[model samples]
Target: MAKKHKPRVKAPKTASPGEVMEIKTLISHEMESGQRKDRKTGELIPRQIINRFECKYNGETVFSADMHPAISANPYMAFYVKAGESGELEFLWHDDNGDVYSHSQKLEVA
Candidate 1:
């Protein structure tokens, strides 16, 4: 599947080891509920939402969520994580159509 938009992330490029850091993420998604009809065709549009989201640091998953239809479009998330040396922060979003979107950020511990 084609990714509609890239995921947004916020984090310091470098931090002291063991320091707590805040992370923010946002992804653009339609979050359809299957109740909406196409404006031009009037055909019922099937539900399409990001079913799941996962955050991993250095290959270890630290946070995850199951998205529901009630979630608004362009989901936003914020969380905290403890820094431990150098690692990669990976974000993943799974859509209802078996499409997976992912983005990664590199972290450096001072």
Candidate 2:
């Protein structure tokens, strides 16, 4: 079974309408590159890493990123978005092994 991961997100709870705010995200992952040999068996560790990330605000995509093998473990990203309305901010991380990590935060516009 694939390992479970914890995702972290930082977003403002409230903002002025049309204001740009910063959003931060991070996820814990091993990010094996498949080039390294296992110490015990001397076999290559299968490559497993988060390959893509997406963020949506109120059902509209705000930011997205494509990850590569060169990306370090526990990937972190920060981006900005304009405050629209009181709604949900959804985040998703896609792993090479077909595992997806999800997180959500709510933002209220004043």
Identify the leading candidate in terms of TM-score. Answer: 2
Candidate 1 local lDDT, 14-101, one digit each (tens): 8899999998999988789788999999999999999899989999998999989888899998888899979799999999999888
Best of the candidates, lDDT: 2
Q: What's each prediction's TM-score?
A: 0.87, 0.91
Residue 80, model 1, lDDT:
87
Local distance difference test, each candidate: 0.89, 0.90
Pairs of colliding residues, candidate 2: none
CA RMSD for every model? Answer: 2.1, 1.9
Residue 109 alpha-carbon offset, candidate 2, angstroms? 0.9
lDDT, candidate 2, equals 0.90
lDDT of each residue in 1-110, candidate 2, tens digit only = 35457898998989999999999898888788878999999998988889999999998888999998888888999999999899989999999979789998888998
TM-score of 2: 0.91
Give the residue spans of candidate 1 off by over 4 A: 1-3, 39-43
